[model samples]
Target: MSIKFWRSLPFQTGFSIALGAVLLTLILSIAVYNQTIEKVVTDSNHRISQLISTIERSASIAAYLNNDELALDVTRGLVKNDIVTGVSLRSESGMRIISGSPFNFKEESILHFPLASPFMPDEKTGELFIKPNQQNIDAQAKQMGALLVFTLATHSLMITIFVIFLVQNRLTRHLTDLANTLHKIEPGSAERLQCPTLHRHDEIGLLVRDTNQLLTAVQNTLAGERRLREYTETLEKETRKEAERDPLTNLLNRRAGERAISRALDKADTNNTRCAIMLIDLDRFKPINDTYGHDAGDHTLVTISNRLTDALRKNDIVIRWGGDEFLILVQQGHDDLQISVIADKILATLSVNIDINTSIQESIGASIGISLYPDHGTDPSYLFDLADKAMYHIKRSGRNGYFIHTPSDTA
Candidate 1:
């Protein structure tokens, strides 16, 4: 048998009950047997008296007639009983007869029955002696004791069997089935435990109902908590996004771009790759704002920002480094030549003409400076400084163009 079966509620309870029943039966049987033996033995005197009374008439006639034949018949009749070992008959005329087993008739154990004359009521005839068969008496008592024990044991066994059956049928079976059903149900399930048909309105039914109510309460609580957690996470993500982005352009701010660039550089170093940091400053932003207004300047900045993002790859980092200045990171193992090609694309994209109104238009241009990773430096501060110096060189030379800050340029 499986360990589960042995460990099950019914099995354990049945085993305990069976063992207890056996023990109870044994105890009760012993008590009943002992008591029966003592009771039968204690009543031996009354039994012997009854036996003597039955043979009294026959014994009296034998003694009065002084007849040896009748006396022999009387002794034979009394000795036929298993409790009588021997009997002696004595007449007043000196007639005597001894019969059955030879036993020393003691005054203590001997039963004396006066054999009176059948016709003369007042006359004392003779005496009858009997030796009580002790072994036979003991045997009878033992027989009665054993019978009582057998009856008690049978009664106890039947009761035990019936009780075990009742317990298994009524309690354990239902409980085990309910447990199995509940085990199959998932913790947050819509399905509920069903009450047993026969046990409706009973304790078992009440238990199932209460348990389902608890499960419903738990599921509802879990659902509410889950929704709360998801809402909290979404709010945190949106807040972080807002903090990381430039308010006007929606591009990554300087600090957030730096963090992202640092992470990318770490990965690039592990992979033995390269990166390009490009810094760009607007060429004629102050003139555009002075010519139109702050509204025109804002429109120009927003347009330029969209142009820069449109010109870069998806993985490239674009940041609003400060007012009229942008920081861009290109980290795809691009060589300096490819980096120069990307810079030309950005310059072309920024030199585009923007529509200020239905009739009026604004021209926005930018000067770009670039630095390569691990060629000039690996540090973000060092690379950014080099890119800024390169951008100033482009500003001094002319606007609307790009310059790569080579290690030789530092010389």
Candidate 2:
């Protein structure tokens, strides 16, 4: 099907094992065939040599007596067997007697035997040549080849099937199960694996055990980190709230107010918008403290803080700027009229009669000083100084009401 199937471990391993078995079987079969053929050829050659040896004395006797009839009889006897295609007996002076079909020197093997005299054994008379038939050898080789092909095919098929069965059951199936288990196991979960053969002292079993140990470690690590992160988040929230809020009024402190103003200035610079800073100081607040004690002063301050918070827009920020004074930062999209309206609301809400639990209704006014970004002063410190100066100017003119700071007002 796909190339991935061929590349998988099972296919590759099975193919390799089958191929190796087939190759080994083939090589052995070829070697056996060659050895058998060689033995047959050697034995046949030996028998042919023996036959020549048996007739040698007679040939020697015939050659010594110069008997042509005996030489022809010897030649004809040698050619009677089907393996012997031809026979030739040649005398000392090259007088030759041949029997059967003429010999084909190129295609046939020639065996030579010397004829010796009986009386003087050392005396050589003639040569005998025998050419064995090639058809008999070819017939034997064909039979052997057929048997070899059948034997090799049968053994190769059996060996391949056996190897595939053994390998698939013993190795590939286990590995496939392990892989599937690992894929389904979620990281940081309480999941575990128990292989059937895990108790065995094999590499696969060891791998399974080690993997379970690693998963346990990961799960523990994840749990610990989760707890630590939750604790850290809680502490961070409490720390941030403490740093940003005033203890008495529950309003943002001076540090938080400054941070807020800096953020607003950055955003205003980017958006080409404007912001306003208003400073409010209560009139005649020291007298109430002097008359009603410090506890009463704290109560009045808390009450006034609540009133100021209720009067402002949701986006506006109010901070306790110090004793009897508060600072407000308003970002209303460059609308000075909206800022003035908010300031008026704060003044009206503060002017209401306040009961200090002293059987006397007390009322006080606030002196408000407003500053605009990029119009009054750009920096926080400079803008605060300008607003403070304007507030004092309102007090100098007479207590109560509000003043928008300008360069001419400062001059």
Candidate 3:
């Protein structure tokens, strides 16, 4: 439809064919013109040689009989012939006895004749011989000109016909077909483009085949990218879900706690402050589960979990660490009083009686130990272990309260 659209098509084999045809036509035309000129020049030289022979024969008769009238007449006859440009009759002493035209023969010059004939014999007049005395250089030049012009006309006609065929079949037609096909190919569509038929064994066929192969490869690559995009989206969602979950609680979880703590820690750690880890355990929890129905005890454990979670700061982390134990990660350790105050708050929260729902309401209490990072221990593990040991010591020392682990008490 448009010139720009045709130029963009990958299968532009037709333009190449048209260009090749034009070049070939030019070369052939030149060769034919040169050959025609050569032939005309050769024919002209042969004709001039024959005319010189006829003049020499007539002159030898006149020279033997001493017939001046006949010699002058033969010379005049040669001049009348259009092919002969110059003529003369010479004596043994080299004086011009007779001549045709005002043109003078300079010396014995015989350059135009293909071969110089020494003399001719005449039977009628009984003469010995007469030398060649005419040349036709101008006639040869005229003949070559006429032949060159004819060759040009003939070759030009043939080239014109060939160019017509190339434009009709090779240039305009094929390019139009390729452009239409290219326009039909929509991006990401499943539509298949049909390859053009190859009747001639030429460059066009090779180009068509290569273009088809490239298109097929492009389609397959696009399909693969689409599939990969969907797979990547699914993997990202799963990774985000994994990132938010805590393996132990199966609740809002530890990574969620870490996210909240990391924000608080970012502020606290920058301000040269601290955060606390509380190690908590149900006092006499193992014995109660061992003596009473373990199912009933599990109910009590669930109740204790709810109470502990409810007691902490909104930003705090509550995690179940194996049987009858929990760990609380708290932010708000700007002062030493922060840890003591949170421990007291948690102890007071656990003082209430919990109804396990499987039976009557039961009374329970917990021992909680407080520790601060960079104060109790520099690392998370160190702080957690020290806090756990303190809680254990409190449980051992008759339970139902909280303790801050001191170095002396640990020793």
Best by lDDT: 1
Per-candidate alpha-carbon RMSD to the true structure:
3.6, 6.2, 8.1
Scored by CA lDDT, what does every candidate get? 0.86, 0.83, 0.62
- Candidate 2 lDDT, 200-229, residue by residue in tens: 678778878899999999999999999999
Evaluated at residue 293, the lDDT of candidate 2 is: 95
Q: Rank the candidates by TM-score, best first.
A: 1, 2, 3
lDDT tens readout by residue for model 1, 1-411: 233878999999999999998998898888888887778766776677788888888888988889889889878988888778888999999987998877666657677778788889789898988887878778888999888888888888898889999998998889988888888878877878888898888999999999899889888988899999999999999999999998899999999999999998888899888888999999989888898898888888889889889888898889999889999998764544388789888888887788887788767788988898878899999999999999999999978888889777753
Q: TM-score, each model?
A: 0.84, 0.68, 0.58
- Cα deviation of 169, candidate 2, in Å: 6.0
- Write candidate 3's Cα lDDT for 25-107 as tens digits: 56765676566555655565566667766666556645555566875776677667765545555433333444444553344
In model 3, which runs have C-alpha deviations exceeding 4 angstroms?
1-34, 42-66, 80-82, 85-248, 251-268, 291-303, 310-315, 333-337, 348-355, 406-411
lDDT of 1: 0.86
lDDT for residue 272 in candidate 1, whole number 0-100 = 84
Misplaced by over 4 Å in model 1 are: 1-7, 34-50, 61-73, 89-127, 290-293, 333-337, 357-359
lDDT at 2 for candidate 1? Answer: 30
Question: Against the true structure, whose TM-score is highest?
Answer: 1
